[model samples]
Structure formats: C-alpha cells, structure tokens
Target chain A: DAGITQSPRYKITETGRQVTLMCHQTWSHSYMFWYRQDLGHGLRLIYYSAAADITDKGEVPDGYVVSRSKTENFPLTLESATRSQTSVYFCASSKGVPETGTRGYEQYFGPGTRLTVT
Target chain B: AQSVSQHNHHVILSEAASLELGCNYSYGGTVNLFWYVQYPGQHLQLLLKYFSGDPLVKGIKGFEAEFIKSKFSFNLRKPSVQWSDTAEYFCAVNPYGGSQGNLIFGKGTKLSVKP
Candidate 1:
C-alpha cells in the first residue's frame, strides 16, 4: 500500500526480553506517533517524533524507547518487556501541526501490531 | 494533562435505529476534536473533525458530530444506522498550540447493530 505500515502483525515475547516494533510511512509525513491500545484505555500515546531527529515522551513512556533516525521510519523498542506491556500497538503519521493560519491535518494510522508478553 | 471520556462503553441497536455516542474532554484551552472508527480487523480511520467555525461537522459514511464548547463535548450522531456501522468509535482531542501533533483518545465505544 501507499500509506503507513507496521511490521510483525502479531508477536509473542517472553518477559525481560527486548522487542522492537517498526513503523514506516511513504507519505514523508513530518510527525510520527506510537500508541498502545488496551481494554479500558482506548489508545494512549507512548511517544511521538516531530521530525527525523526530534522525539519526545508521551503520556506513558516508561520502559519504552523510540527513535526516528529517518523521516520514513520510526521504531519503538520495549526494553525488558513485562506482561503488562502486552497490547495492540498502533503507529500514526501526520503532516505536522497546522500553523497559525492553516487548517488542521488528519492522522493516518497503520494496521497495528498485536504484541503479547508471556 | 488532558483526557477524553466516552460516555458509553458498549451500545446495541437494531438496524435503522438512531445512534449517539457522547464524548467529552478535560482540556481547558483551544482544542481540535475528532471522531475515528475502526471496523473489524481494520485500522482506525477518521470519521469527522472540528477545529473551528461551524460546530456541526459532517464526516464520511453518513456520520456527523456536534461540538459544544461550553459543555466540552463532541457527540456523534446518525439518524438511522446500518448494520455496517457496527464498529468501535473513538473520540480524540488535540490541544491547539501544542508543540507536536499528539492526540488524547477516549476509551472507545463499541457499537453492535443487529441486522
């Protein structure tokens, strides 16, 4: 497809193991985000990158790491994964926030990766 | 910190029945509202959004939402829903003037329509 994509649609990992989720977008969007969806928490932002080299923490960032070395790729790594980290992960991309006199832009989401920590 | 609340966790309705999903946010500043839908085994897609101006915004698939600034609510509605409308709906908000384009999402409402 021409939109965003995530690798390893489904994954199973053991506790204390390191797992990485990859996200790629062909649109050259300036902003990329990582979110985890749980039963009660619809989708919580874990991290977000404004550009290739600028990244920041989101609502829940502990035990999670993200890097945006290139505009088309944003990878999220969970170091020492725990059972509580098992959830569906979604990646989204946007063309950056609108400036003072511009309209807002919609975000495009990837097909989500289902991660299970055993 | 900002948060979104979805009034209904699960809703069941027959075909052609009216539909309404309530959403509220806790942000005090200017914000942009959005409604997203996820079908079975599909990614989330934007249904509607309200940034400014008109409070009532129309989205794809015959969906619409009204943004009430005073109540801090954006409710999704449809006069008559089809079985195809059965899916999970989520409400999200993006605070205006925020550095990044991050969004705070509601806990989603699962709608099941009987054919």
Candidate 2:
C-alpha cells in the first residue's frame, strides 16, 4: 500500500495486441525503473525515468515504450506484444539524495506483472 | 557498458551451512554495488550495498559482502544459512560517471537451503 505496486499481476494477451502495465509508487520517488525478469537473464532494465516527463532507454528497450506523466505513475506500453515479450515485468522506485548522487539510493520493487504473450 | 557476473547459477546447501555467493563486475573506476534478494513469489529486496568508505558492508538478515577493488568482486556471504534463506540473489552495479539510474544486474544465483 505504501510502496510500489503494479496492476494486472497476471496477464494473458495475444500477439499484435496492445497492453499497458501500470506502475504506481506512493513514496513519490524521483526515479522509477521498469525491468523484465527472464530465466538465465535475471533482471534486465527496459526503461527508467528520472522524474515526471523524463524517461530513458535501458539495456533492452526494444518493443517497449514507457511514459511518466506523473511522479507517482510510470506505465509501460507494448504497442504490439510478441512471444519474446512474455516475461515477468517488475517496477521499482528509488528516492535519490542530492549529496550521495543519484546512484546512492536503494531500489524498492513491486510484486511484478506476469505477462504471457500467446 | 558495465556488467555483473554471478558465478553460481544454482547452489544447494543444508541448514546451518555456511554460504558464499560470488559476484564480479566489469567496470573500471568507482562503482556502487548492491546485492538483492528475491524470495519465492515476492519482489526483490535489498540485502546489502557498497558505495564508498568501508569495503566490508553488512546488510539485513545476517548477510555481509566484501567489495574487493583489486579483484573487481563483491561476494555475498552468510556464516550460517537457514531454510528461509532459500531464494534468488542478484548482484547489481552502477558505475560512476554515468547515469545513476542505469544498473547492470547479474544473472542471479538461486540458493536452495534444505531444512
């Protein structure tokens, strides 16, 4: 309730269909991240946002789009889902401190969104 | 690009057994390292982190890790592990002089502590 949360914990969608995974954090952290957890790959970052309206690509941002219209919400959109996109998606938030630099914060993660692209 | 490597993919041990998970990174200069634990059907939680100052960092749940600059390693250790400690452990790194939000995570080590 007080931490980060992801909507639609489990999703089943067909190929070529659009789906959005919502992430909300009550902490109002400045930084938010979206990652996909796959077997043998661990957790790979797809996108990250520094603040509202500021987003950047991560290691595997292909076929994935993210928007941060508000500080508390960072939603990831898949215009057309594919089989490769079927994985456990995770949303995390971090509160950055100015003195310690941005990397100084610890990330808190949500339960996760298990998406099955059939 | 910075990257993290976890040597063990799966490890099995009994209760009260000593545990050590190896983690290495391929980044030069200063770095911020972290160890995160993900229990079964749960989100990832921070175990310990190494930023600056001391190389030996102690974290939650009787866990500790040592950051060796010379070896470019940050290995997690626990003197005595319990069945509850069975989970996936990930090592991540954020190399300095770049975007702080960019964190390179390891493949992760799955620990199975038998009771």
Candidate 3:
C-alpha cells in the first residue's frame, strides 16, 4: 500500500490506437521513469520526469509521451500503438540524493504492466 | 555511451550449489553498480549497490557482489542457492559523473535452481 503501483496490469490494444499506462507512487520521489522491457533489449528507458510538469526523453522515446501532472503520478502515453511497441512496461521512482559528486538515484519499481498490440 | 553486458543469458544449477553471475560495464568515468532480483511474480528489488567506499557489497538473501575496476566488472555471488532463488537477475550501472540517473541494465541472467 505504500509503494509504486501501475494500473491495467494487462492491456490489449489494436494497432494505430492510443493507449496510456498509469503509474502512481506513494513515495513523493523526485524522479519518475518509464521503461519498456523486451526480450533481448532488457529495460530501456522511454521517458523520465524530474518533477511535476518537467519531463525528458530517454533512450527509446520515439512513440512514447510522458507527463507528470503531480508528484505522485507519471503517465506514459503511446501516441500510436504498433506491434513493435508491445512490451512489459515498468514504472519506477527514485528520490534524488547527492552523496558524492554524483547524484544517487536509487529506484523503486512497480509491479509492471504487460501490454499486447495486434 | 554507457552499456552493460551480461554474458550469461540462462543458468541452471542444483540446490546447495554456489552461483556466480557475470556483469561488465563500459565507462571511463566513476560508476555505481547494482544488482536487482526479480522473483517470480514480484517486482524488481535491490539486491545490493556499490558506491565509492566499499567494493565488496553484501545484500539480502545471502547475496553479494564485488566490483573490479581494472576489468570493469561487478560479479554477483552466493555461497549456495535455493530453489526459491530461481529468478531473473539484472546488473545495472549509473555513471556517477553523468547527470542521467537512468541505469544501463544488462540483458539479465535467469538463474534456475533445481530442487
């Protein structure tokens, strides 16, 4: 009840349709991230938000859009769902703390959302 | 570009057998290493993390990892594994000098401990 949670644990959508995955965290962490886990590619960051209304793209952000309307919520929207976009999505949040010269962002992950596109 | 390489994709062993999972990263700057375990039907949980002071870090469930700079490797080890230890293990690195806190994860090693 106190960790990050994702809605629609299982999703099925058609190609060309728009779908958004919801992510919520009880910990008011400073950073929230969206990652897509495929078979061979591991977990690739799609988008990350530093704070409310401040979002940035990551390694794979081609068809994905993310927004952080509140400190506890970061939603990832697929503009146009495609077969290639099908993957298990994991939402993670981390509180930014600078210990050394580098800012340490230890992430806490959600249960993950499995989406299938046909 | 920072990248993580995990040589083993799948590994199987009997109960009470020792385990070691290899992980290598390509980066010239300072780095922070981590090992995460995802049990069946569970979320990813931090097994251990390495910062600056200690290179040999111990984690929960009798898991530990050692960081070697010369080889740029951090290998996870356990004296013995249990059937409950069967899960996907991921090695991740965050470049300490970079602003992107995002982690570069390996393809992951799925370890199966046969009971």
Candidate 4:
C-alpha cells in the first residue's frame, strides 16, 4: 500500500499485440526503473525515468517503451510483443538526493509482473 | 558498460551449514554495492549495501558481505543458514558518478538449504 506496486501481476498476450505493465509508487521517488528478469540474464534494465516526463533507455530498451506521465506512475508498453520478451518484469523506485554528490540511495522493488508472450 | 558476475548459479547446504555467495563487478571507479534476496513468491528486497566506510557490511537474518575493492569483489556470507534462507540472491552495483542510480545486477545464485 505504502510502497511500490505493479498491476496485472501475471499477463498473457499474443505475439505482435500491444501490452502495458503499470507501476505505481506511493513514495513519490524521483527515480523509477523497469527491468526484465530472464534465465541466465538476471535482471536487465529496460528503461528508467529520473522524473515525470524524463525517461531514458537502459541496457535492453529495444521492443519496450516506458512513459512517466506522473511521478507516481511509470508504465511500460510493449509495442509488439515477441516470445523472447516473455519474462518476469520488475519495477523499482529510488529517491535521489543530489546533495550527497553520489547516487547512494537504496532501491525498492515491487512484486514482479510475469508476462507470457505466445 | 558496468556488469556484475555471480560465481555460483546454484548452491545447496544443510541446515546450520555455512553459506557463502561470491559476487564480482567490472567497474573501475567508485560504486555502491548491494545484495538483494527474493524469497519464494516474493519481491526482491535489499539484504545489505556498501556505500562507504567499513568494508564489512551486515544485513538482515545474519547475512553479511565484505567489499574487497582490490579484488573487485563483494561476497555474501552467513555463519549458519536455515531452511528459511533458501532463496535467490542477487548482487548489484551502481556506479557512483555516471550511473544515474541504475543498478547492474548479476545473474543471481539460488540457495537451497536442506532441512
């Protein structure tokens, strides 16, 4: 309730279909990240947002799109899903304190979204 | 690009047995290291972190990690592990200056402690 949460904990969609995974954080953290967990790959970042309307690409951002229209919501969209994209997706949030001159903030993760693309 | 490497992909130990999980990162400069645990059917939670000061960092449930800068390693250890300690453990690194707080995670090690 107070921490980060993801909608549609489990999802199944056909190939070439559009799907969105929603992430919401009540903490109002300035930073939000979307990562995909797959066998042998661990958790690879797909996209991250510094603040509302400020998003950046991560390690594996190809097939995935993310938008943070509001500080509380950062949704990841799959333009046209593929079987390779079937994996557990995780959303993480961290509060940045620029005064520290270093990015030492701890990140909190939400219950992952298990997406199955067929 | 920064990356993390977890040596052990899967580990098995009996109850009360000692536990150790090796983690190494490929980053030249300052970094913030972290250990996260994901219990069965649960979200990933921070087990411990190393920002500065003492290299020996203690975490929840008798878990501890020692950051060895020279070796570019941060290995997690526990004196006595229990059956409840069976879970997936991940080691991550966030490079200090240019990373923008994005973490580079390892492949993770799954620990199974027999009761």
Task: State which candidate has the highest lDDT.
Answer: 1
Model 1 residue A31 CA deviation in Å: 0.5
TM-score quality measure for candidate 1:
0.96
Report the C-alpha lDDT of model 2 over A1-118, residue by residue, as the tens digit.
Answer: 6789999999999999999999999999999999999999999999999999999998889999999999999999999999999999999988862233544667889999999999
| All candidates in order of DockQ, best leading | 1, 4, 2, 3
The order of the candidates by lDDT, greatest first, is 1, 4, 2, 3
Give candidate 2's error at residue B75 in angstroms.
Answer: 0.5
> Residues A21-64, candidate 4, lDDT per residue (tens digit)?
99999999999999999989999999999999999998899999
Docking class of 4: medium
Question: Against the true structure, what is each candidate's TM-score?
Answer: 0.96, 0.95, 0.96, 0.97
Question: In candidate 2, residue A20 scores what lDDT?
Answer: 100
lDDT of 3 by residue, A45-104 (tens): 998888999888899999998888899999999999999999999999988733357546
**Per-structure clash totals for the candidates:** 0, 0, 0, 0
The ten-residue window of minimal lDDT in model 4 chain A covers A96-105
**What tens digits encode model 1's per-residue C-alpha lDDT throughout A1-118?**
5799999899999999999999999999999999999998899999999999999998889999999999999999999999999999999999977545677877999999999999
Compared to the true structure, candidate 3 yields what TM-score?
Answer: 0.96
Question: TM-scores for chain A, candidates in order?
Answer: 0.97, 0.94, 0.93, 0.94
Worst 10 residues of 2 chain A by lDDT: A96-105
Between 1 and 3, whose lDDT is larger?
1
Poorest stretch of ten by lDDT in candidate 4 chain B:
B94-103
**lDDT, candidate 3, residue B68?**
96
- Looking at model 1 chain A, report the run of 10 residues with the lowest lDDT sum: A96-105
Candidate 4 residue-wise lDDT, B5-111, digit = tens: 99999999999999999999998988889999999888999999998899999999999999999999999999999999999999999887654568899999999
Residue-level lDDT of model 1, residues B11-99, one tens digit each, is 99999999999999998888889999999888899999998899999999899999999999999999999999999999999887887
